[model samples]
Target: MKPSNGSTVSQQSALSTPSGPSSASASAPLAEDDPEPRPAVAALPRHVFSENEAEPEEGRTGDTPTLVFGVPASDEPGFREELLLPTYEALRRAFPDHRIEWREMSKFDLILAVVKREVDLYVVSSGFFAYLTHGAGSSWLATRKIPQASDPEHAVGGLVVARAADDRYATIADLRTARAAAASSQSFPSWTAVLGEIANVTSYPEHFLGKPRFTGDSGLSVVERVLRKETDVGFLRTCEYETLVARGLVHPQALKVVGERTSEALACRTSTELYPDLVLAARPDLSDSVRRRAAAAVFLIPESASGYAWTVANDFRSVRRLVARFGSAPSEHAEPSAALDRYKYALVISVLLLGGAILYSVSVSGVVARRTKELVAVIDEKTTLEQTARVSRERLSQLERAGIVSELSSMIAHELRQPVAGLVNYADGLALYLSGKQDPVVEEATREIARQAERVSSIVERVRAYAKGKSDVRQPSDLCVVAKRAFTTFRSGADLTGVRVSGEFLPEAPVSGDPLELELLVVNCLKNALHAAKSSPDGHGEIRIRVSDDASGEKWCLEVEDNGPRIDDAKFAELSHPVTSEKFEGLGLGLSISRVIAERHAARLLFRRAGERGLVVTLLIAKRPVEAEDASHGTGGMNGMDGTLAAPKAVPASHYGADPSRNVLSDE
Candidate 1:
């Protein structure tokens, strides 16, 4: 076996058991000498084998398998060797025909030997054995029972020690700034266990104990360093100090245990929780029969002088928890530095991916905002075009309707002109016959008949000129005179049993329009009002004609109001066009013709709701100045009329015969 630092591997033959009478004395001479004297053995258990022990049933043969036992070399001379001597002697006695070899190596190398299948069985720390069981599929065989331990499973723990003379360091807190020493970083009880305990107290265990110095492969060196003041505190396996004191190597009062714990089943002074001690485990590939035989041989070995025996340990959970708390278990595959390098690469890639995602999101947001803005502008343009198209359609329809009405009017006037002339001639002859008779009522009736016949002739001429598209002769006209005359005619012609008519007129409200056309406009308004009022559900209705000038004296308004069922906005809008009439005998041209006449005079025809149950029709025309009467006389008359300007005929107010209480006619 070669020696490296304090670790060495020694291969020994199990058949080379000592022939001496005492096993302790026999095992003492097997240890290799060192510069420092080794501690004397305390006591040795009785040897497990006798000279007449049973041999294996199968005799020694060339095909006999050799059992390789792996053991970790310790820094302390002869410590592990002497402890395992009896088991070697017992195995040699049990399998006399088979060969047994002892192979010693460092703890790390021994674990590798087991993993590589080079060693059939091995001795390992409880914590490392748990790691092997999980990571390497190693199987448990037995656990070493510690001397004076109440429970074999609770035999191992770590110790924190300070110089007894140093009063400044007594508890674990006192060692926070103290330099720490240990047997080896790989030693579980001396190093890992203590670190795990300190980890429980502080998040940074490295800062808690400062930095630990690993002396050698033995806890004895750790104790020596503490005595020399090279380290303020020393970490050791449980009972290591007591074992040294028993060997008379160190004084009992030389050092003190920091934060020592007392346990009912544990006799050792420990600074951490107890776990199972050394375990004997078999490689998974080993034969079951061979494994059972090896375990039986381990159980046969008597307890050592230092109180070491083997028994099955059902639980190693405490050891497993300790290893897990310290982060990772010992592995032969990778080092810590290599794993850290992989982590660095992963972090850089993650950051790059995150930055790219943010940039992508911002770009997408900008694109969506621009798209939304463009869509809104398109929508607004579409709405404006739609409105323009609708207005154009309405104007085209009105022109078509007007053209049709014009043709119809021309035909009707042509057909009626001769008949109207014949009626006028007949009325004239009758008036001549009745003039001298002087029956007052008959005379007045005859005059009315002539007047009406002449009115019909004038209306036909106006319609014929409109059909010919000839401009009418505009003249200075009083809207009040036109309104009063139209209202008087409407009252006389229409049934008025339950109907009332009234007029409110601005006496000289003036506007520039053809007098005949103005009269036609007022007459159409009164006709519509009377029809609306008579349609009322109560069969009682009122009509009022109002002519007034605006405050600015710029426009004259002729308003016809009636207490009738009102029309909704949609129905009223239809009134401006030649829509189907609501009345049974109506031709639906009254309002439309009125609108055309008002437009000819550059005026507006409007209709509105009056209160909750009425309709009001208004004609707004530009006011005429007094001087415009002479200005109009200078212009010639209409196309078919003579070149003379006919003065507006005057009608007596008494001819209206309006009832003072009901049919009121006011000249305001």
Candidate 2:
């Protein structure tokens, strides 16, 4: 009787088959009431071992060995059970005392079980068997025989299938850009075998099929997708199309095999070189006697019982080669080992060269460090030389300014003498007229007028003396009073038509300077502002004069601003020093002299372009303490001379239109 569960069968019934009544036949007599006495059931036969065939060690121990057979879980539904049933039944008949157990697991788990010796034997694809033989030390017992194939070893391969109606893919190469489907990426016959064939024809086998979709576990789905136009091509196991057609699961005319190869030994249409079929392999640790018996039992299976037979295929060289080419071979490490051995000398030479490069880098770094230090010393020397040159330039500039001042002094003195004489004549006439009238207010005003005329003469004489290198004393004076006086004087002399002039003055803004020179500087700035304002496009202009002290009381400012045509920043920057005047009918001496007087008072002259239009000229000076003026009265002033100012430094010759060759100062 066949095993009910297909996993285990009792040895008693297996041994008693055909020799005695079955249990059903014997039990039927027990249920009968008719008294025709049944002849006694034939006694079950006992087998005896020959002298050369010793009893199994398990039989001696009275414990049956359960032979576990493992199959891949990825096999099609019912394929595992059907494939192994014949072998299971054959093993039961051959060893009546042994037990048989069947197991289904993934290919990876099945390999692990075999390697761990958890399963005594396993049946897996030839590709997996090749791995087991080399990696897990499994011994091949038999290779499955294709019933119609003349050669068992050349029985299996992959098929590239496409819809018969689809003329787009007639061959494997034509399917490169076509949408392709496969059973699984891990399926050997469905994917790897096809890939191997493509690898033979092209260097890039992975991309030959373009990106194929993997339908789960069975190639039938891949065929269905191809027929439904879901995919243009499908990869299937060899004979899978024919098997589906025979089973009525597929219409034979619906799909065609691509790149089909014909072999007298193989009956199926295959696109790849035929390799060995599924293998029954024994674990390395399985007993030799049991392994031999199992192999014999597998060989004894009648082909009629399972429609397939097991045969010993000594040549799995083709399968092994495919596994190696696909990089799934257990001996994959051998390739890298051989490469390393071949290049060992070159590797050593490269190491030596790298070491030399590192040493050279270290030496070069040392040289760079030494060179950097030398460069730093050279830079320091350059800086020191630049400083010396700057000092010499300043001294030379001072001499040039003095020479220019000396050259202009006579002309300046001549111009001022006439103004001074006119003032004196007017003052005398006013005094004479007042003497006759004897009005007290008029007499005081005439005396004040004469004093003012005397002060003008004194100022012109002092300017000429200063040009000749005489030191005039500086005294604490209210800058606000000076600026107010300059503004009043400018307003009196200049045309006031179409121009508005205003002043913002502090009550007291004290600074140490020659008061006459300070007033002259303010007057010059006011004159320039008035000129700029009058040059406005509209002919109507405004000028504002401001005299203020900082909150610290240590500095004071005189600012004169005008609304006129906007001066470019470059031109305004040039105004910081006295440059040639851009105006018509004007000498640039006005600003040059103003700058000199400002320098003598230790003040800075700054020119800035006002927003939208015009220029703002500012004189920034350090404020002098009130006590210093009293101290100065007891002693000499800045030049240690009473009532005289210190001689000014020479200005750059560039400012005075002197010979450029003699100007040593850089514009910077």
Candidate 3:
């Protein structure tokens, strides 16, 4: 609507009418007929212009601002009531603490108001910034509006008519020929826009329509009269048509398009097309920082009121297509016309980004799962191989012991050969003496030949015991009886060899093992002790073999300790090694095989130095009670006739050896 004449440019014109003396600066007062005291604050910053400073934006937060919004070049608001809140509500919702100022100004003047700080900020279409700064040299520090996320906009356009009655105006072509009810000459919908914009003049004669019907009001009101059937064909925005139609007040079948205008900012509908409708500009002189921030805040307002976003300092190239598409023909929006259109680019980028995120997660999972499987397999195989290796080592130990014993048997046989040869010579002498006559010495000679044969036989038996590993032939025998039997049987040469041999008779410590094997082990040690003593001329050491029960409540141990010599740990260990003697005169097999037999009977052979001098060889043999004591008397052999420990008749000393060192070292 036109402002009151007293408040418009008429006041400026009348200011020049006063003929009083005037200063060269034209600073003269206007005619004072309309007198109203202007408030002192009116000349101050807050009162210079009014919108934001006059009311609270919302929560009344910071300084109250004066907000002046640029008017759309067109008169219609396109968004439906469902989406668009009134401007008052939009400002309240955005700045809850501060009041917002509102104004209706020309789009270009709105830009100047903001530049002069006469307004806080304004919202506009995309290319408005380009217009202000194109050659204005202020674009360097400006911020442009472009959304980072998707947002939708709402906008509409208008068509004009001379009247609303379709009966008189069957179509726009018919009305154009009659008369027109156009907007002001400078209005986009009015006369000047016919040639397009306020500068161009074309299309109608001044008297072509009845003396121009002087409506002298806003463009929207002129269109309203036609809808009321007061005029013929005229122009307005499509948003205006939809609003009246939505309020159940109008119908589209009542009119037809006889003319159209074009723009790069508006979308086309089957009903009308025109310039894109939006706030098109803001002032350029405000600090670039504040201008940019306030522009963004306006866009942050609900799209229901202002549409998608504000154009801060954006150039025009981006929106030209949208701008070019707008016109005054009513039509539906067209389908996509190119791959690089906004919607297409958005869809392609979205798919690529989503696919990349999914592939990244899958790759990480695949690597972790594969490594777990590989490590698990390695651990399982290592455990299985270790068990197999342990079993293999035990079996190898047993084989080594058996090999040494077989080799030792042949050496022992050679040791006994000489005694048997001497027995033959002695038997022949006794036979010759008895055959010629019964001499008194003849009986004595026969007894000596028989003793020689017994000595040789005992040596042979001990060697054979080791050959069999001594595990099969077992009997219940007292450790003491076993010791004594070996003593009497091989005790014949003990004194002659200066090897005193004796025993501690712990008769109750009975054991169950091969009788011969027990004798071989005990006698072998005793014989070794005696020989060691005999080798010393100053030696008076007695080989005292002891058969005793260990104090450990459940065991029987045969301890044979001698003072013959002090043996070292190395010699003691070597004595039990399988092939140690294969390279020496001592076969070393005796102790090793004895230990094997001991293990079979759940026993152990413990050898160590004893009494600071001699060796202690103990047979920690496991025992069982003897049941058939009547025949053997717990000795290992049959004996009873004289209540004495009767040794079997033995071979004699006629088997004396020249190389004593080559003797088998057997004392029984």
Candidate 4:
């Protein structure tokens, strides 16, 4: 998942990067010499693995428990075909007392299946497994030990490549403006790994990579994109690249590896240090016995065309950290370190001078000799660049933290200005009234002074709470009362013409959470909606809030709808993430904080495009069961048997899984 800076030492390039057959065959890679690829999975009966032809008779008398194995569908049609549609006989022999069923799914669906207990185990890449572990609490049961030719260990690396003729891409620094072709966004080698490497060396990694085009689902697609010049650079897992070359699908000299690094212990060329390979992880509820039995059977699977055998899982902390670095939200105040900027200018000059010398030499020598010389030059330059990048990375980390603090200080000062000014004005008015002997005006000024003081106190409290990462004091309360109070507070601030704000609340909506926090969440959403409606092209808008039970009848839904400009898909995807906003004012932390509050309440916060005109944000909360004592107090905490509010359980990913097409946050 994460890329590495491995050392690249000079040698006969040919010796370091072998142009030989895969370990599987000397003739060709995965050709007719190998077994025919399994047929594609199609419509199947519910219990596809029920056939008992290969099941042992001794275990037939007992009740049969079914275990479902899930496999995420890959773009390479044949990659997962054999694994998913393995001969039923093999599964029967391996799991004789149990029925084995296979489920092919998309990534999102696969995660949901695990969360909802639809599948017992799933085979996934290390990067995706890390994502599940962080986002859904899934854990690994076992990992596959691929062939030495495939990985040499439980880990695998990735290769970043460019056309052999393109001389500009000599190092990671030279890849600044290059368009990249990657596999799926979730892919470790082709996407996450490449991103991690670039991010280490650059301040704005997104701009450096120039918006990569997701080619397809396989490593071969990356090669094809590079060869066709659809992308300036390409990324692939090391083994996949070598296998393609061995099959003659790609020419050995057609492409040059970027950041090419050689390790004596590594069997293949790589641009990144190896990370843990694919793994078989289990759902949270899978029994230890079943997990052990499954792991044992998978280890017994002899090496086949897939070039893998199951092995004990290695520590995947490195891969998890790698993903965390890339997925981390960018600091709004971040800038390139001064040291890096200085080095970059120096690097550019050196590259230009070296290129000029190489061009002159090429003119004297024949093309063949020039090509070999250029290869050596590139290798040497990349090694130097890597060292420079390492230094820059160290400086960048220190400077980044300082920049964020400075930016936050400036924002806090800006926020304090309004209330401070109001307080001064109130003080001046009171002084004038007292000097003029106007008692009535002095009384009014005193009240105004109290209000301004409270406003300042409130602002300071908010800043302190955010700094300390504190959650609100929670209790069982009525959702409708919180919504109404929040609506009233928001209405007091909204001074717009031709904008109608309306709310339809159900009679009773009991929820177990902080009332103040719930009110704040509602206020923030309403405030954001008002801003959107004000910016409507038509200059007229309607914002509506409705409280009712969701279609599922299990959760209470708070839907906020607005008639404003439709947010572009790209911006919509990042709504819940903190960033500087172009349309809304302040620190751009409102929606992000709202998401946090939603999480604390064990609710789902979703944003979706409402038809062709505006956006709709829905908050789905688990309905709280009301007790007899709850009705006694109009707005007090729930009095359950424990004399405290029931702790909220987080809604499973299954809640969002039902219809992702309608919920943008669900995809994230």
Which candidate wins on lDDT?
Answer: 1
Tens-place lDDT digits, model 4, residues 96-145: 66766556676646645655557777777787677657655566766755
lDDT per residue as tens, model 3, 496-519: 455555455542555665555566
Off by over 4 Å in 1: 1-362, 432-445, 468-471, 492-501, 510-512, 527-543, 562-592, 602-617, 622-624, 627-650, 657-668
Candidate with maximal TM-score: 2
Residue lDDT tens for model 2, 56-113: 4432443656677776653232233345667866776766666566666666566556
Clashing pairs in 1: 9-104, 43-305
lDDT (10s digit) by residue, model 1, range 180-235: 99877777888778877877778877678777898755666776677777788989
Off by over 4 Å in 2: 1-63, 72-83, 105-112, 164-168, 175-179, 228-231, 305-307, 327-477, 485-503, 514-598, 604-668
Error of 2 at 323 (Å): 1.0
Give candidate 4 regions above 4 Å deviation. 1-64, 72-91, 105-117, 149-154, 302-307, 327-668
Q: What C-alpha RMSD separates each model from the true structure? A: 23.0, 15.8, 27.0, 39.0
Local lDDT at 645 for model 4: 31
Arrange candidates by TM-score, highest first: which order? Answer: 2, 1, 4, 3
Question: Of the candidates numbered 1 and 4, which has the greater TM-score value?
Answer: 1
